[model samples]
Target: MSATARVLVDGLGVDTVCALDRGLSYGDGLFETIRFVAGLAPLWSRHMERLQHSCVRLQLPMPDAALLLHEARSVVGGMDQAVVRMTLTRGVGERGYALPTTAHPTRIVAAFAAPAMMGDAYIHGIRLRWCETRLAIQPSLAGMKHLNRLEQVLARAEWSDPSVADGLMRDTDGNVIAATMANLFAVVDGVLVTPSVERSGVAGVARAEVLASRAAVHVGDISREDLLRADEVFLSSSVRGILPVQAVDDTVYVPGPVTRALQRHWRGLGFPMEQA
Candidate 1:
């Protein structure tokens, strides 16, 4: 826990939500999991863009960036490294499904210490499992980090083995989508290939950074066979950065040259991913 781990509603320092809040009644909200170092979010613009896109899709008013930044800075004040999560809800509403005539969006921002999983995972690699739960094809909800995440919740609950660092999930059509917690990427014949999030899955900020970097990137459908036969594989997230995948099921893959090059690239960008 961070000494500054606290939640604020709207712009006030508060800790509770109303019973009829739309976010509680229905999963009507968007959230951004941001990594802040020295009281600044390096990828703040990208996270804000994604949050604004989700608000537009949900017919909710977008928040002002200056206010959000101020609140986030307060929450992460004096922290060397922290994870600051901001959630915006549609506010309280009636019992019916109709949108309230007067919608007051609720904002909650909280901070926590960054989890300590980057040491060994970054140095060596992580083992993965194939999850049985599949994500439904909902184009309207695709690529948005909305509050409704039961699909990921169920997929993450499939395994209890501590050795399995993460699980890979597919869509209803059996196309590989992403890992339960991070975006999936594979290097096929020296080209960086990542599953398109058009039909499902969240578009991770770190994944977007890697795609926009000087790496050869391709976005399309990746089958199970394609993933297993790829030369290198890794996962991307805001908190964890890039994590190499050591094995999936019975197959084995050592952290290859491509993964190493990307790690170097990410470190050069000021996201020191290795143990100090």
Candidate 2:
């Protein structure tokens, strides 16, 4: 997993970095996992928007966008196909939860090879297990992909079933939110419904696309029973695109009309299925 990376910090904007940044220390930062297409990010605007939203919510200063872009290009310049991870921190705040009044935020942009291809999800669906760890409902940081992801990490670690491609998680109130790492959607009576991310779950880019394309997308509190009784289920992420879930618990479902239509739309958008 060794790879080249670049760092910019503390207004000086030098590349060689120290390990003492607060982003690493207290997870007191925000980040975005961006997909660079043809040496460009098609969804760069969305990523930036989300990053800005996260920074405001976290009370962290927004770093210089032009510098961040320049650093990102440098990081991605040396890689063939890459997923760039940009991290912004509170910039070495004094040792406490108190915010530094005027410290510059530390920024790091690291690029690495895109995930190994897992083949066509449209033809062959993936399996998912229910995660035991329920999400804590935090409306304040609900939809942004913030740094505190220990809940997902723990949920993923609960099972070593490599057969299970991912795990679906619910919140403490039994509201089905999303998978351990991705957003979920279900087709109920020809309608595409995703859990309302107003309480939890990262509002994924692909999920936004589908909701926009298919105007009737319902975002509301969904229960596990609602998931089980649905006609079809699928997951979406920036990297994974559209992944149909064949089985959840003992009940199973094929990729139904709604999911298939969404996949078609997603392909037209840019990220085609591996088989397509």
Candidate 3:
């Protein structure tokens, strides 16, 4: 694990960002948390596609995908395992809501040590809390990996217990959105039911993979009652992959056969399944 984070700003080696940057001021940006093993991000194309879509939606200049990938590799060096965070922010702008005519987006790519989770988490599953911080319904920002994460930050702050893996979040309409840092999925009967990010939450890469798989998957609305009544519950992310949820608030669920099957599939895809 690297003790220091390697960072590149605008394709150049830099560690500092301007205070006037729109991302810092108004969270006008998009970011992706990626997992790299053997100096390669397995879902590089997906991340790029999402980033491009975000750029178009936000009217920010899109960074060169090839250049960004090259810089990402340079930051990773020869690290066997690492987590790369890519932040693309609308460059320095004056204090106002008005759009800046001269927008030079800043691309900050950094690599840090991949987090080590306890192996027991994958086996026994982890507990989750029900966050009171409800996500606002903003269809324009829905499903994009934008940098406005105050909602997630507040939800994560609701719990301090290290035993708690994450917190399940909901929209203002009381519809289940996802976990604070991952996408939520529940196995009902033999089908996988996940919340649609059309109104809130992120469209996770791991969640995308699961939806694309041959498994019986359904994307639609999910309520808190539905989650509690499900046979199995799990969270998916690019870095964390599929994490079985043993409990959410008072509801308890053991990692069922379906959760185990997905875990095996992830491991087969060359992800490091072993908990640190």
Q: Estimate each model's TM-score.
A: 0.95, 0.91, 0.96
lDDT tens per residue, model 2, 67-164: 77777777778665567888887877677777788767777777777775465556567889998999999898899887899999999999998788
Expressed as tens digits, the lDDT of each residue in 150-214 for candidate 1 is 98899999989999999999999999999998999998877889999998999999889888884
lDDT for position 253 in model 1 = 84
How far does residue 251 in candidate 1 sit from its true spot (Å)? Answer: 1.2
Q: Which residue pairs show collisions in model 3? A: none
Comparing 2 and 3 by TM-score, which wins?
3
Summarize candidate 3's per-residue lDDT along 133-236 as a digit string, tens digits: 99999999999999889999999989899888899999999999999999999988668899999988899889888887745788899988888789999998
Q: Which stretches of candidate 2 lie over 4 Å from their true place?
A: 1-19, 78-80
Provide the lDDT at 223 for model 1.
95
